[model samples]
Target: MPIPDGPTTYRELAELLRGRIEGGEYPPGEKLPNIEELMETYELARQTVRAAINQLASEGLVRTVTRKGTYVQARLGRRRVRRNHVVTRSRAGMYIFPAAAYPDEPWQTHGTPHRSMEAAPEVVAEQFGVEVGSEVLRRRRVMSPEEEPPFQIVDTWLSPQAVADAPQIAEKSTGPGGYLERLEEAGHGPISWSEITRTRMPSAEEASLLQIPGVLPVMEMILVGRSGRTEDALEVTIRVIPGDRVELVADLVRDASAQWPLRTAEPKE
Candidate 1:
């Protein structure tokens, strides 16, 4: 095949291949033309073709495995995570909901929680209305979906007083009733909760831990569980979800009292 009438740069070659991928000429999971073939086809150098392939890898449109030729990555199907409790809570009300939002696909999440006590950060202090440096139980968990990449990273902070007797909250699994039930038993029953959503490029550590590609932003959900009709939050949990793999939906009701579309506390400065 003749090279297109243009400067045969790496970018131009990548664009040509990208067009093929988008045109379905090379279907998902199908191996692309090998480096030598691409170089000969595009009349480019080996290094030029390699750079073009790397471009595709960085864009997450393709994957290159060791000893395995590069293949077009399957377009990632996203799970719809809702803000409604109906979507979040199971019918049993005690057990945690499955991470796989799709009913057709059976997905299980494995969470490894690293528990520790850390002084409250300035933002946490403001969110919980506690003084900075207050002792809070911090549980950082990475929830990996079976047979795929990670689902989300969750960090939960509880007042020492709230989880003093609730040792189960620190474990990998809370077993029955989850942490909320345990907290309620400890006399800190959460009446209502709020969340703040934001998006940003993942940090180096976060990208490594989540096993995602470069510049892929992550959706952050900051949730605060509060006691009945009180501003004092009992627990603050933050979930980091891959923006590429998660979509959130929430039903809205027009109310003069409520300001935001989602039920979330004011962001701390």
Candidate 2:
């Protein structure tokens, strides 16, 4: 592993193969060692190891099986909570409230209930700052996790006085307590949260609402949720998930002379 010399930058060979696949020295389903053996073991160029395996397959950490080659892709699990911490545990808690307050229960008569449809799309109305025809609410959800299968769809929107002070935000169940505790029990107290994530290609009604099958690719996750004392934007969700069972944890705190400027074009009028 001596490489590092003159001009090798694909973000420094993708941080030296992401520190040799996070130091297991490349393990998880293995494979990787092609592009002419990673340009003869990192002496570089084969377009810098194919731009460092396309930046580790755009950071989901590799997986490009065409004729079957670049492997290793299964390492993103730890995040049951915290990081924009919202917290919610029992008594059916995670925000699914309005099935006419559970009319004849049985998990609110087995599926399909949370509905508030309309207002979004203009890229979710500029990611929830709103005003592209106003009135946003579109709430649709579906999260089944114990032993899986309903995988998650979540559409969320809010802001009609945060759904008229939580008119049970249209109900569905799996979260009778957690959209930041029904946005602090409807007084709307979420402060500021962001999220953003990528990897798309999903609409045929979101590939049949996330049952996902064809070449499997969803992982979208927009999530905005703000408000604590006028940060404004109350909620915006979008989820979709199922990139082999979601795991998106972001904790970044490094500050060694922070400059971090990588702005791609958006202002040239």
Regions of model 1 farther than 4 Å from truth = 1-14, 20-59, 62-73, 80-92, 95-100, 103-105, 117-125, 129-136, 144-146, 165-168, 171-175, 250-269
Q: Which candidate is the best by TM-score?
A: 1
* Per-residue lDDT of model 1, residues 1-269, tens digit only: 84668438999888988999999999988999899888777788999998888888767677665576788876667767664554255666763433326544555455545788888976578876678998788888777556776777877898665665567776667767778877677666544676678887777767667766545678887777776534467788877877778777778886777656666668899
Estimate, for each residue in 169-244, the C-alpha lDDT of model 2 and write its tens digit. 5555425455567667566565466667787666666655544433457667676767786676777777676565
- Candidate 1: worst 10 consecutive residues by lDDT? 95-104
- Output the lDDT of residue 38, model 2: 69
- The list of candidate 2 runs beyond 4 A from truth reads 1-25, 29-37, 40-48, 55-72, 75-123, 126-155, 165-237, 242-269
lDDT of residue 127 for candidate 2: 60
**Which consecutive 10 residues in model 2 have the weakest lDDT in total?**
96-105
